[model samples]
Target: MREHEAQARTPRRDARSAATGQARRGDVSGLHYTPDKARRSANLAAFVQKTRAVDSRGAADLQKLFAEGDFIERIGALVAPHGLRIDNVADAYTMWWITAWHAARGENDDPSPATLTAVRAQAAHAITATGEIARASDAQKQELAEALWVQSALIDVAMEQAKRDPSRLRAVGDAVRQGAKGMGLNLDTIDLTSKGFVPVGVGQNDAPATTPKPGSAAPYGALALAAGGIGVGGFLMLRQRRG
Candidate 1:
């Protein structure tokens, strides 16, 4: 992604309350990634690099998808901020989900077209199951989390297997579905189309801010201050001379 592209959306905060609140929600309903964002998420990039077939076609396709696909773009947005950091469990979960999502959806070695459809179906089911699990017992939540991670892992394995042989799409799909059962959450209602910053703090609102870029100088203020200082200094110098 171009630096200007990243610079375009000045790093404004949605009040600490909002950004952090989203962080705390532990839900993935409101996460969206635009085409531009996917290009910058290092974690996603790394995953692509490690698993994608090393060729111009694969490279170009991945790049293009990252820049244009809604799903890929959302993954990019999430990956960019944390860059593989598991600091927040929500972020970690989001990253893993997207990684799995992308791996399954891609035409790469992982999921054959038929299997890919099945994988999508499984994801839909997993998503639904996740919502149910949310209201279930603690044991259920733990079980759900594990199931989600496993399903996600199967996506990775499938992708790897595809890259290695390219004929195991069915196997990959089956593996992905089976693994998903181990993850405790579902993917259906966890909306991935809408994304915004969430903030949190005492009495703090989660409204996004409109501010100048960090490195951008407040030229007007600086000039005004300088002018005032210069005027004061000149007056002091003149008075001293007169004395």
Candidate 2:
């Protein structure tokens, strides 16, 4: 995709919570590539999702929708800090669900238009069925964590599929100092459209609604969807890339 839609409101956390989060930053091992390494301690905050109600059972059902794909490890690296507790089956299930949400591949290394639609549909369903799937302080954190997953996962897809490679992942990573630029915003403040950050999106001009673009939504539906959700003014642009 030429641009990944991304946008976020400023943080709503209190200074004390912010400070505590800062103190805990160094303990996060999820920043690496291991899924089981990001745990710190058992946190009890409930996920108050806005879309719908959910529970461990509902989350397990959602997991069945996930697709198997490559570079899921890359996606885990992005959201590891927020933490996932295997003791909490729903949280762990969601971690896997979100990971597969981004890493699944399709025919010729790209998904068909129908596949893209299905991806977007399932993401929407996830929002509905995952009110309590994650173990986070609140919905904002959930959004931040998931948004980061989208970022990392898209980079995985874009590495080989983006036709223009304008925001070359390698160069862009260097520009952000390996995501430090965005992370400096305290997760909530990381502006995807910030200086030097190119938002990724799906589709191309003159393309059919369901026509697949190389690395656009056809290949990176989760990425495209996340960009639109977090993107400026909450608009998902729907822009596409060339073949």
Candidate 3:
């Protein structure tokens, strides 16, 4: 009976090994076998590599889009309903792009409420600039809408990434600045002032220095000297009158 049990276990072990071998050979029958830990790790690494490749492609595309002269025009019709002008849209887009880039790098990319409000206001102005949002053909409108959606999605993803890692904000800013320069735009001149968002290292030169009010208290030593001088002058006058 023990010999028979050993023989039976040998067949089962052989079958299991065969299945694993088939799986290793990329057989469809091996689908039922769960991959080993090493296999799983390889799959994960491949997935990450693919994802990074896609992201790199997207970043290149975005850079190309930024450098195009007709970028604003292409997006203008889509944003018209929100009353945004070309400049307004450009400003908002730049803001979102910079923030999104920072966020993508795992930086604190949260925009201030003022910045949000300003962007919204510009979008509104864009709507007014177009005079009518429905003027574009349906297909054109759809394309514009899709483009805007992509932009918004990028921003959302960046924001989420930034939430996970906040150390990449400076890098993000540098990236945006470089991108803007490549497009013949100055990052510093983007005009966030209308939204109450001043760039770093600005406004210091124009700010007035504090001045003391007239007739304020003098130093203690000066006060003491003045009092002593008055007292001596009075004593001299009194002594002269007596003489």
Which candidate comes out best when scored by lDDT? Answer: 3
Best by TM-score: 3
What is the Cα-based lDDT of residue 200 in candidate 2?
38
My TM-score estimates for the predictions, one after another, are 0.28, 0.23, 0.31
Give candidate 3 regions above 4 Å deviation. 1-115, 130-135, 159-186, 191-243
Superposed model 1: Cα runs more than 4 Å off = 1-96, 106-132, 174-243
| Every candidate's lDDT | 0.34, 0.29, 0.37
In candidate 2 the C-alpha lDDT for residue 161 amounts to: 43
Residue 84 miss distance in model 2 (angstroms): 7.4
Candidate 2 Cα errors over 4 Å, as ranges: 1-136, 162-169, 175-179, 185-243
* Model 2 agreement with the true structure over 77-153: per-residue lDDT tens digits: 33343443323222332332332322321111233444433433333233324432222333323334433433433
Prediction 1 global C-alpha lDDT = 0.34
Give me the displacement of residue 171 in model 2, in angstroms: 3.4
Tens digit per residue, CA lDDT, model 3, 76-190? 4433444433333233343444443343344433455565556544433333344332233333333333333333333333333334344533444454345334433354543
Residues 23-87, model 1: lDDT tens digits: 54543331111222323254334433433443434344334433443333232343343342222
Displacement of the residue 10 alpha carbon in candidate 1, Å: 34
